[model samples]
Target chain A: MAEAARPTFRPAHTGFTDTIATVVVWLIAIIVTGVFVWLLSDIIWHGIGQVSWRFLTEAPRNAGRAGGIGPIIVSTLLILAVCIAVAMPLGVGTAVLLAEFTSSDNLFGRLVRRSLDVLAGVPSIVFGLFGNAFFCVYLGMGFSILSGGLTLACMTLPILIRSTEEGFRAVPDEYRLGAAALGMSRTSSLIHLLLPAAAPGLLVGMVLGMGRSIAETAALIFTSGYVDRMPQSLHDSGRSLSIHIFDLSMNVAGGDANAYASALVLIVILLIVNSVASWTSDRWLHKRIIS
Target chain B: MSRSRSDIFLIWALRCCAAIAGAIVLLIGAFLVIESMPALQHVGITRFFTDASWHPSADASQGTFNLAPMLWGTLLAMSGSVLLATPLGIGSAVFCHYYAPSSIAKFYRRLIELLAGIPSVVYGFWGLVVLVPLIRQLQPPGPSLLAGIIILTIMILPTVALMADAALTNVPAQYLRGAAALGLSRWGTIRGVVFPAAKSGIITGVILQTGRAIGETMAILMVCGNVVQTPSRIFDPIRTLTANIALEMAYAGGDHRSALFVSGLILLALIVVLVSAAEVHSKGRIYG
Candidate 1:
């Protein structure tokens, strides 16, 4: 009778504790969601009014206090182009080596992965120092778009390679076996079959890398320079979108309006890119399932 | 058989790409060391640890290159953000995993990803425009260590929550079922079985976020008052190592520039240690 009473009494205590824990957890969830909503709305509320057609098409005047971010947009695109151009081939090739050519325990593959992991964690400001030292000073590139793009390439490669590797790894082993049975040369099979199948992964990696490179500021500050003029050539210095925002807000007094507008444009670009990535992956998944 | 030539070429090309990718890390390390050598030699390494303030001058002799205060600032901001984020992140993760409907959990995850995708500059801008002003009402000077902590906490919260969610999801379903079989309540089971099973993964995530928090630059630089001091109070302004490099590197030249690189080198060394520690902690774990 005593033991039964003890078990019955425990429910009252445990039940109360459970209810409190559940309430606390629900409260935390609501708070986290509320914070996100607040941040998004705050930016959108102030910035949406500032963004206009003219804002996207014209160059800034009075050190970004007036006019638009026309040249900054071009510079941002060119820098991104250079970054992707350099990173894609190297990233895809490395991913191929990791996923297809090498075994899981291969020493060289492990070394490469370890290095990439360390590289991914390296601070962007440090990358700025390295890029300034190597590309600008030692290589005599100065503070050009080329230098900044190359710096971004180094920063973006690890993310690209890792994701692409995962993409390749997700392909079924039977597909490879079938290619072998069909007497398809390894190069041909990888080029024709593997690449297409892993396209979603590659797309994801590219979008993520682009997003990171586009949003970069510290790495570009010392390497790409602070020039806000229309870039005449890849060799010339040009301020990127993020760098422009940093400068406008921090240095140029009364530059907040344009800063908010530019930030809105950047956020829009990121949202579009993210949506496209997910949409494409979703379509790919549907196609794969249907077939 | 003739196609074998192309295959061989493709193999070699990939090998070369992998080699280059691996070598870039070595190259970055080498360049940082070479660039920072002048400052390290001129100022002497011991002084960096012992000096009282950072006053980098064109003349190397006159400047005091002590990084201790900034180092302290970086660790303080990093630890504070991590401490605040850990509970909030894990609580959200737990909420999503056990309590929320699947649809709500999915939406929440997407929201977290969107939060993560926002650039650091924007966070800093937001912090400067909104958060700092709010804090200023409570305290006189707004752009202090507290502001940086709050901004950093928001910036890293998504990372922690997402990683923690993944870790929680990776917990074996059998563990929960076993607790249920033993008549344990849901929260009781989480406290006793689920958390213990997922401890290493959550720790690894936290450590990785620590690396990110320490290395973060633009956000902290924008809001933090950029004062070079060891902050005694949370409201006191502070400068981090990353911010130190970004702020001073533009006008810095000769040994001053080299000293900035020394700071960069220190940051890189710190990151390498954190990454290694995470790897060691997650070793042999499935979630790694």
Candidate 2:
């Protein structure tokens, strides 16, 4: 038995398998990321040098050479503005209700919470269908900027409410009790105390929701018709960057440069919005830790 | 005191906003049901479920809106994507948790986060230009089930990886250390002890990822080729329920509309089953 114990270092040449697995995993991660980059490269490699400030300012090309995304840009900003306007009050208002006044398991409260989750889960295309039927066919609003913005507002509502609710809950109950000791009502305490503390976080959630809305394509495609024109009326159809990229790529007839360039621009926009959100959340977390 | 009363009233009113958001969801389900009723009555539920025949363009006199083909296609594509993504996702997660340098793991997390950030439509476009061509090189046609699976798999990789990594992190270090102390190698300890402990979480993540695959629409529609036929083979073209609904919703008439709603209901049911099972399995067991 002592002699047998001496032979433990036989070393079964397992290096090959371990090395192979490590390399394979690393390569897969690299290649997957590279493909995403390469997609942008394929488009910008063709169209980046061609775009100018003028390209961003002018209306889309009618003659099919190389026009700008001015209308798409304006429309996107407009829709984004409209969505923010709708979602902010709606989302923060709901969050405050859940955090302060509503009792747990209240039927309507539970229903609202569950509904928000379900709304978050429903596919974008389904939302598109609803918008088509309810907004276009039933409401007679047609495929316009207003319809698209309203639908987007609905899409962003859940994120805003959920995040804002979390923000409100994070504020200490001690603060509320202290405010009450000073003859402040729950609402007064929330407005003057709880809300200010929650403001940074509620704002972050709004940015994230806006990013999600901006990056959205399927929901907007049917709700907002692929109108190439700048919006003159709320009823006027307008193209956002996502729609423009989808449309151009579908034809393969529209220059590949335009589509790729549009995608690159849109991706950059999303990154900016998402980063702002991430930064905001991080700052709040750090502040909470320090205090 | 009057100010306080107004404040309390404001809070009560704010609560209604939350109710409205939730009401919107129930309304969507109700709306879909109502819109599809005409088709439901005309076809009779039996034919819609049992029959594999779908001739949307067929003469109405013959009566056909068979969902069987579309359902089969949906399952096949999801199954295909799950098969491709799950192992890679788990592998990546394992590497991130146990093997990669701290910097590398952080980078990997950020990369996956960015991947998740890309809109579904961009994935759709990439599939159109790049992935389709790559698949065509392997097979003759540009758009096939293979292409759809490849795109969907890539699209879901970040979600699965993030969840799996969280699961792995949740595994206790004590078990791994105890295994190592007893005379196991690092890999051996991980393979034999850590992974088993993480199994419930891993399995739940896999099921949830499957649910996501089942429900995904836009990226899938772009590459699925949108044909209405039973999937014959791995490489054959097919139409998924989501694709069918997207492609036809513009002008679907009568039972054709209800057939689409039935397709959606089927999808919702599949997701509900997967989610409920995971919920039960994961209730208190998952560490992360």
Candidate 3:
């Protein structure tokens, strides 16, 4: 009876047009892949020659025409640290509040979500202008590491909040129900159960946020003056690796090789950071599914 | 009344933090409006937006603040890039969804992800080092509108491809099976049924790509030649709104600085409208 009721559909031979379409689409995909391989090989071939101990450790001279990027590397790390420090807590707190505390259907929740959407869509250059107006001038932080960090924090806040909120939403509702049955208070359950379960996703967001802070050049170009020396404190102006790459490629004549090398380093850093974030997220997801 | 004081305190603290996140968006809007007020007042909104010349300080008596050329350049570059990217992106999506084997599909997906991860500055570097010289052979000025458009097309392809792939995959298996049962060819099914079903999703991706193309700066800055003129040909040099602000903000002050802020404001307004439109379309249901 079941066999009779099931409509028998045989696999049909593909027509010529179908075959042509498939082949064309396949060629297109291969071309995109080929482009990627070409870009990577081109950069790595030209850039790998510039990386060395001396290159990484010594301060640049001759207006970045020669020497190393030690100060630039330090300043990049410093700026990232400050950006993450300011953004992480505020972002996570807001995500937690939105996910667990408030009803998403509520007007306030809707408004908050809309605002985040708007913020996330904003261009980085606008953030540069804002940093120049608000942080460097209005707040009197000047074009220092602090100003750049703060500027990045604002740029990254919306991203972190959205990602963390997604992370929270990924938590199964059963955990909350079980905690309720166990008479666990809302705060305690969030601290002890929901947070531990959501830790991996949150880490993914944090790492991604770090990547944004690291890759940022435009906002930093304004809020952080292009000073070549190693910054002794947050108040002093600094140059990040991305900014260094920009300056070398644009401002100076015949600084192409160094720019390529620094770009290789930047891409390498980004790859490592992205891979770790995805790997951690996948591992945690697997573990959650297993036990 | 029975709630613990600590619980109340904790809730309030989290709420305050959340409010601050929302408030930042409003604050940015307010700050841009206020900072740009000087330019808005000096040139008047009509002249600032309508004038084609961008002499911000030709003389104390009269400084031109026209935004026509920059706006024209921004739209020209964005439209040129997005139009070029859309078909290639959709084609790649079709390949991934239908043609590729599982291993090849996975490999291609990872390649696209890595492409998306590459920084805009790296794109700019490659453009300056490789693309510009290549273009120089064709056009005397290497950093032309064509270069910017090409760089942006490459940058946005991965984003468009990924989004489109997701949309294509989300087309129900039942639809494909039904078409197959009806004796429709694979290409016919994709074109007549699957494409229509995934239309909204693909539109969403294109809208998102448009936003990115408009907002892109560093790469365009490196290659757009920073000419404050309307581009008559693909190889003509032009200055986008983003490049204009980045180019002059360092030395600009008083009314000149305010003019830059006003440019930023216009950009912000444009982005908000695009993003909001994308959001609305994404939420809209097309099929019964």
Best candidate according to lDDT: 1
lDDT score for candidate 2 against the true structure: 0.75
| Worst-scoring 10-residue span by lDDT in model 3 chain A | A1-10
Candidate 1: stretches off by over 4 Å = A1-14, A282-291, B1-3, B284-288
Here, model 3's chain A TM-score works out at 0.93
What digit string (tens of lDDT, one per residue) describes model 2 on residues A30-110?
776676677657756765775778878888885224788888899988778877888788888888887777776677676
Q: Whose DockQ is greatest here?
A: 1
What CAPRI class is candidate 1?
medium
Task: Give residue A190's error in model 3 in angstroms.
Answer: 1.1
DockQ of each: 0.54, 0.39, 0.50
Q: CA shift at A225, candidate 2, in angstroms?
A: 1.6
Clashing pairs in 3: none
- C-alpha lDDT values of all predictions: 0.88, 0.75, 0.85
Of candidates 2 and 1, the better by lDDT: 1
- Could you tell me how far off, in angstroms, the CA of residue B172 lies in candidate 3 after the best superposition? 3.0
Candidate 2 wrongly placed segments (more than 4 Å)? A1-24, A63-65, A102-108, B1-3, B49-52, B57-63, B171-184, B192-205, B284-288
**A93-173, model 1: which lDDT tens digit per residue?**
999999999998899998898899889989889899999999999999999999999999999999999879878987888
Whose DockQ is higher: candidate 1's or candidate 3's?
Answer: 1
Model 2 scores a TM of 0.88
